[model samples]
Target: MILHAGVLGLLVGGTVIVALMLFGSLVGVRILRTWNPMSTSEEQLILERQTYLVSVLVAVALWIEIGSALLFIHTVDDLHELFVGAMCATGTLNANPVGWWVLAAKGAIVLLFPIWLAVNGLDQRSGSFPLVRLKYGLLLVLTPLAVADLSLQIAYFGGLQPDIITSCCGALFSESSDTVTGDLAAIPAVLAFPVFLAVSLLFLAAVGWARVSPRPISRIIAAVLSPVTLAVGVVAVISFVSVAYYELPTHHCPFDLFQSGSAFVGYPLMFSLVAAVVLAAMPGALLMVTQHPALRDVAAGSERRWLTGAAAAFTIFLVVAIWPLVFGNLAWESM
Candidate 1:
């Protein structure tokens, strides 16, 4: 099965990551927790090197996760032909409870990896590496999550039965359906569209203002932008993504976008928004590295660059998402 192939890749990648993380966690608890900055001990030197090694491995593993997420979704979309009632990736995912759990795990892994990178960045900037324990401890925590992700992938793919019929996106995401997605779909475009636009603009404006503002003010804006960006992502589903892909204002089903030509924009647009949030949120590393006054400048410089990157990413998302409505010659009707 296509899903089996995808799950196989995840298991391989996740197992390697979990092993490295376990080592890192052991070092954190037994050595790094008590190591001295001034000690010229052999153990301290080895611990430092081991830390870097774990980081390199984890970073590579995280990169694999990003690719795996896309591959998983693509495989599901491709399997629609084989699935008795699947019309797209969404339908395939709706096939069983395990499917949604797999998706949740994928989302968590993607989101967590960047935060791990931020933690590592904080440790890198600290002269004494005070956050070493925190970083390794986090790695330990994430190890279980990665394992769960692997387990969920196996369960999802294993549960898939070609003989069993499943509901398509049309039925699962329809207005009358009793799902959370259905409720979101039922939100009239009249309201959802404006809210989506307003939220996006607010996010854009806040991040822009943050670029030039003082650190405290910029941090506040960053704090607000987090939730706003999340809201924008949600509305993008029920409003922009659904409408653009389906070419029908009322057909607010996100899965439909992964079908045929619409698939071109679906994942790319979603990825762009996610990238924007990841970039914009990097300045938060400051909270972890504040012990080192020297790193304040480093944090400031990184914040500016990352927020600018966020803006650029969001701009790309806007262009890609609206292209169908403006230039793809999509048929549209008044909301």
Candidate 2:
């Protein structure tokens, strides 16, 4: 029964991601055509507008995905029961094939959209917020979030142990029994600190260099951001390590590590971290758009029209997809 439920939940979750990706790709392609002409001025405006709009859209999507993931995690036990019943009714559960193609498609879409936005957005001629700067800033602010996440993982998987005392030093020590699980499961917490620390130091160095020299500090700021940028590179390595070393080989069930009650509590932290990063970046990006010469022209005329249209279309799509779930009927009474 439990196995069946796990499979069912995985199917539903994968379906949702696939739907979102299909819609998002259509939106991306439409936006891309507007820039086919690719003039200096038009291209700059298109990129800036797209950056802000896409960031906002992704932030919204992430919030929804996190919430759904948590809910699915919490209700995993019930799902397991459902799975068992289905298998019993059908007689041959082992022959059923899981949808790996859907999973791969969804993953590609989710990852590619952000890279598309970041590359086009940052590559513009105007001296807007460098991609490096925003990346580093995100790293610094999410540090505490990372630590809290690690602690939670330790609490969840690692069983409690009695405190140990050293006879010579009279020091007490304890080890967490929390075993790491899925790659995605550990990321929000573990990566937060190092990302934050590297970025903060770079920003501080930029400020110091500015005070000491008469030259324009943007180049210095960009330079400081370069090393911190390497943190993004660490993501793949960490994810691989997490899956290879932390996850159990046989725990094919998606929700094995998720606890429903704890999900509502823990999931909110993930949303909060993402929201913080977006909120912090938005104001500066907005200010930069107004001040940067190349961007100023893009905002002036019909170019702004196309940008606004694209943003509005994307927003409408999100509203259509999310509103029903948020306000729709509940199956059970709340505690």
Most TM-score-accurate candidate: 1
Give per-model TM-scores. Answer: 0.90, 0.30
Q: Over the full model, what C-alpha lDDT does candidate 2 score relative to the true structure?
A: 0.33
Put down candidate 2 lDDT per residue, 1-335, tens digits, no spaces. 22344434444544444444344444444444444333568765665465455444444444444443444344433433333222111111111212122222323333233333433344343445434234323323222332333233223222212131111100100012132323323444235435644554454344344334324343235333433433332332222221222233221222221234223222332223223222222222344433445554443332233223323332332243223224434221210
- Residue 317 in candidate 1, Cα distance off native in Å: 1.5
lDDT, residue 172, model 2: 9
Give the TM-score (vs. native) of candidate 2.
Answer: 0.30
Against the true structure, candidate 1 reaches a TM-score of 0.90
The 10 consecutive residues of candidate 2 with the worst lDDT sum are 166-175
Per-residue accuracy of model 1 over 142-217 as CA lDDT, tens digit each = 7788778777877777777777688887776777889877777777656776677777888788788878885565
Q: 108, model 2: CA deviation in Å?
A: 10
